[model samples]
Target: MRSAVVVPETPVKSLFAYPLLLSLLVGGPALAQTATRDPAQIQAGTYAVDPGHTQVGWRVSHFGFSHYSGGFSGVSGTLDLDPKNPAAAKLSIRIPVGSVSTTSAKLTGELKGEQWLDEAKYPEMTFVSTKVEPVGADKAKVTGDLTLHGVTKPVTLDVTLVGAGVNPLNKKVTVGFEATGVLKRSAYGVKTYVPLIGDDLQLTIDGAFERRD
Candidate 1:
């Protein structure tokens, strides 16, 4: 028999590294499965929204010459998802209206004030889906009631499933989606500048949710 080679153990940097390492080891198999897993195989259940990973942005025409964009900072929600029966999936999201931010602090304040979003009076905006219509394998049209600026209106979003997999750091099954829609701010009673600032606003949503045990 050949002589046995001896190996030295490398010490882990910190106590925090233990869970991280374990997560990678345990999550490896799941991560691999994600690539070949069909959408129909996605676990059906309620997933808790990962607030830190969610974003909602809005773009509007600035003076008929260019487009400007801004976004809200805080978002929370639950996604009731069923992969086999995609039409059964539903979404409920809450947006803190006061979290609106742009390139300038002054503009941000103005947006929350009466002339724009009037967030002082309406502190939050929300969307609750009434129906989800699958368009293709990984896309859908989600219709819902959007409550913004104290006005409620029906809005439909073209949504696409971005990806789904086990997060190696957290070891949780995560799903991500992107959505886009348009809303007329004037219909929501925020017609400040009208044609000058643009009445129609484009909304974009990017969010991820982790499966809840």
Candidate 2:
């Protein structure tokens, strides 16, 4: 037999590196199967209200009577979307509290007062998202903090992504969605009347934001 050649073996060879490498390779495809995992792949867009098409409307119980509804005229927002990673997303909206209309100036003033929106003191109501959780292929839950009547509270919205595609006007990708949530006005220090105008306020928003240029 030829002279044996001795070779030093590494006792601490990395088995750990192999799986990590494999995971990096296969993990992407696997995670993609459920939702997007690429944050950088997501797009950011700004949406201006058509004013004609968009609306911010709310309804509340009227002394245990029929549901009374009213809408706001000025509404605007922007959307941050990550198609490759749905979890990494955010949305924000702002509306003028004084824009509430009820077909009566007296009612409008009342809405602006402390009994309702208290618009003179708090001119605007805003919602800023904290986290995004995809509900499915096209639905999500947006957890955010909403400041209304100068009171800030955490709120969650059930969101349905209407669609995302190209826009001819701006020549950019656009996304549309509808979200709804309900909150007790009193919870946000909006407490004033209980059964007269009702405490449960239902919020509905129809928004469309386009990719920024």
The best candidate in terms of TM-score:
1
What stretches of model 2 exceed 4 Å from their correct place?
A: 1-52, 168-172
Model 1 TM-score, all chains together? 0.83
> Model 1: how far is 21 from its true place, Å?
16
lDDT of 1 by residue, 85-113 (tens): 89999899999999899999989999989
Model 1: which ten-residue window has the lowest total lDDT? 28-37
lDDT of 1 at 11: 70
lDDT of 2 at 157: 94
| TM-scores, one per candidate | 0.83, 0.73
Superposed on all Cα atoms, the candidates' RMSDs to the truth, in angstroms, are: 6.4, 19.0
